[model samples]
Target: MRIKILSIAFAALIVAAAFTFIRKEVKVDVKSSQIAWVGEKVTGQHNGTVNIKSGALDVENGTIKGGEFTIDMTSIDVLDLEGDSKGKLMGHLKSDDFFSVEKYPTALFKINSVSESKQADATHFISGELTIKGITNKITFPATVTVNGDKVNAKATFALDRTKWNVRYGSGSFFDGLGDKMIYDDFKLSVNLSSL
Candidate 1:
């Protein structure tokens, strides 16, 4: 009986040590991360960028177990326009008709799960809850993630329906007779992240 008890305790210690070795928490390098946005209308398309405020990732056995990131919505910048034309668009985007950056200056995404991707080019499928303008919604996208030593790099591109998050504005679904003034409901976001 004594020998059996000792063996059981040894097994428990081994399991605990293995678990500690497999799981890790890493801080995100917000300065090195980038999130680009693209919005289209019947007339043309506009592209810009937003900053990542902070983030962290849970890595387990070289795979991302979970992660969360905060976006600085007030950092939205238009790259295609210059002078007042750019200023006007930026003002409108921050107003209540769009992201309402004054009321909600930051957006957040928290990962709920991650799974190996079946896509040839993608590494994993990440499911998470995205909160914008005080509204939270579930979003899933494929990402290419790599881990080397203490560093991690990830990239993902996905489109989100603005209407689902109550970003109505000139959306054709909410307003008729918009014609060319109507902005498409879906907007694309491309994210690149690196670990500190």
Candidate 2:
């Protein structure tokens, strides 16, 4: 009777261990990660970087489950210009004509879902809500996500229409006859994020 009881207890312990999940929440390396952006008009374009304020990622059994990030809108940089020109553009971006960063100094992104991709180049597809200047929109994009014990690296290139978020300055969609001075509605972002 004792031997039978011991065998049953050992079997139950094995079953419980098998059902245990391996999951972790990792904070992103804000200084090492970057978000690059590009805005274009008919004649040319401006490119810059925005700083990430804070972020964290959830991993389930070595797969990216979800994450959320906050961006410092006041940290916008116009990389191509120099001196006063850079300052002017940066100021304009922060003003009401553009992002109104003084009023809304932060933008946020919350991941809703992540799925493994069938393609070789991209590791996963992501769907999330991106909030800019206090407006939130659902955006979906593909990313290359890699996981190595305790570390995660993710990269993606995606486009967002500024007008969708009520940023209508120089946009032809709202005003006509702008000709060459019209700015395109779509702005691009290249994101690279690292978390541990």
Candidate 3:
């Protein structure tokens, strides 16, 4: 009887280990070159990619595995703000009046809760924290993910207020005699992530 009971327990342990070994993890594909911020005829591009980082996950019943999506902010864009007058514009953008890249050069987003409302399309509502210019804010956005075999793709769009980060240069401080138009208050980001 003792031998039979030990054999059953050993079998159960093997099954549990196999299940853990086959568990899926969340993956990310970073394409930093795909980010841009354009306004008032000013546009900037990044070097290399945006760090395009990823993190661990827990998959439950084919769901997200866990309720977390994290990113590394040090992987953010360092705009190539140099080229003729446009280069000067980029310099201005990086100055203390604008992005203050010297002090705050990274932007971060971390998803805390992800809820699935549909099964066929795999639509999700992800809520997370966004940090910029040393300020942390909570934001919730929509992400649509499609899975095929071991590959996955997710895309989303969101906006942020430049003023919130103290990026106030040329925003409204323009001299009237110089006669300059103030840039808009909001900045938008479009993201498409693919994982394997």
- CA error at residue 5 for candidate 1, angstroms: 8.1
For all candidates in order, the CA lDDT equals 0.94, 0.94, 0.58
Q: Alpha-carbon error at 175 in model 2, in Å?
A: 0.9
lDDT of 2 by residue, 87-144 (tens): 9999999999999998999999999999988987788899999999899999999899
Name the runs in model 3 displaced over 4 angstroms. Answer: 1-24, 31-33, 38-61, 65-82, 117-122, 170-180
Per-residue lDDT tens digits for candidate 3, residues 69-167, read: 444443444354435754665566666766566777666666677787564444987677777677778887777866565566667665667777666
lDDT for model 1, on a 0 to 1 scale? 0.94
| Candidate 1 clash pair list | none
TM-score of 3: 0.63
Q: Over all chains combined, what TM-score does candidate 1 have? A: 0.92
**Full candidate order by lDDT, most accurate first:** 1, 2, 3
Quality of model 3 by C-alpha lDDT: 0.58
